[model samples]
Target: MKITVDRDACISSGICALDAPTLFDQDDEGVVLLRTDRPAAEDEQLARDAALACPASVITVTEVE
Candidate 1:
């Protein structure tokens, strides 16, 4: 799966990082950071859940293929 995040739309929420630490992270200023655009198959669900848990709704998860 592919994961994308809109930093401009992020609200410093750490939900993404908390939910999917391997796929997402927060900068020192709390902006959303993309750890990897393409996540492993095992992490697909984590990415999806992080997307759903994001309060700012900035995280987007999509199928790579």
Candidate 2:
């Protein structure tokens, strides 16, 4: 699986950071930023949680096309 983030819509709510700190962090402007491209499979759940936590729906996850 792959994870992506859309910066324009991000508001840096820190939900993603709270949900998946290893995969995301709150930037100075308070936006979710991916720290790594390929996170562990075990962290996938947290990543998904983070994605869902975004009010702006800027996070994207894809396992296939």
Candidate 3:
């Protein structure tokens, strides 16, 4: 699975960090940053939860399979 973050829609809610700190973080401007390598399969469910929890709907989770 691959994760895409819509920076424009992100409001720095930090939900992603809460769900998948290994895959997402906030920049100095409080914008969500996507890991270049994306999230691993083990973290797919949490990542999707984080994305869905985002009030801005900025996180997009795509399944490669």
Candidate 4:
């Protein structure tokens, strides 16, 4: 799966980081930083949850064939 974050739309709520710390993090300015756009199979669920937990709806999780 591929995770995509729209930095412009991020509200810095930190939900992504909280939901998937291994796959997401915050910058010094509190902006969402993607630790890995392409997550491993085991981490895909957490990545999706993080995407869903974003209040700003800026996180996107796409399934790659």
lDDT of each: 0.89, 0.82, 0.83, 0.90
Per-residue error (Å), model 4, residue 5: 0.3
> What are the per-residue Cα lDDT tens digits for candidate 4 across 1-65?
88899998889999889888999999988999999999989999998888777899999999988
Query: What lDDT does model 4 reach?
Result: 0.90
Pick the winner on lDDT between candidates 1 and 4: 4
State the TM-score for model 2: 0.87
Higher-scoring candidate on lDDT, 1 or 3: 1
Tell me how candidate 3 scores on lDDT: 0.83
What is the TM-score (0 to 1) of candidate 4?
Answer: 0.94
- Summed over model 4, clashes come to 0
TM-scores for all candidates: the values are: 0.94, 0.87, 0.87, 0.94
- Report clash pairs, candidate 2: 12-30, 12-31
Q: Candidate 4: worst 10 consecutive residues by lDDT?
A: 47-56
Q: Which parts of model 1 are misplaced by more than 4 Å?
A: none
Per-residue lDDT tens digits of candidate 2, residues 13-54? Answer: 788888888998877889778887667889888878877888
At residue 21, candidate 3 shows an lDDT of: 85
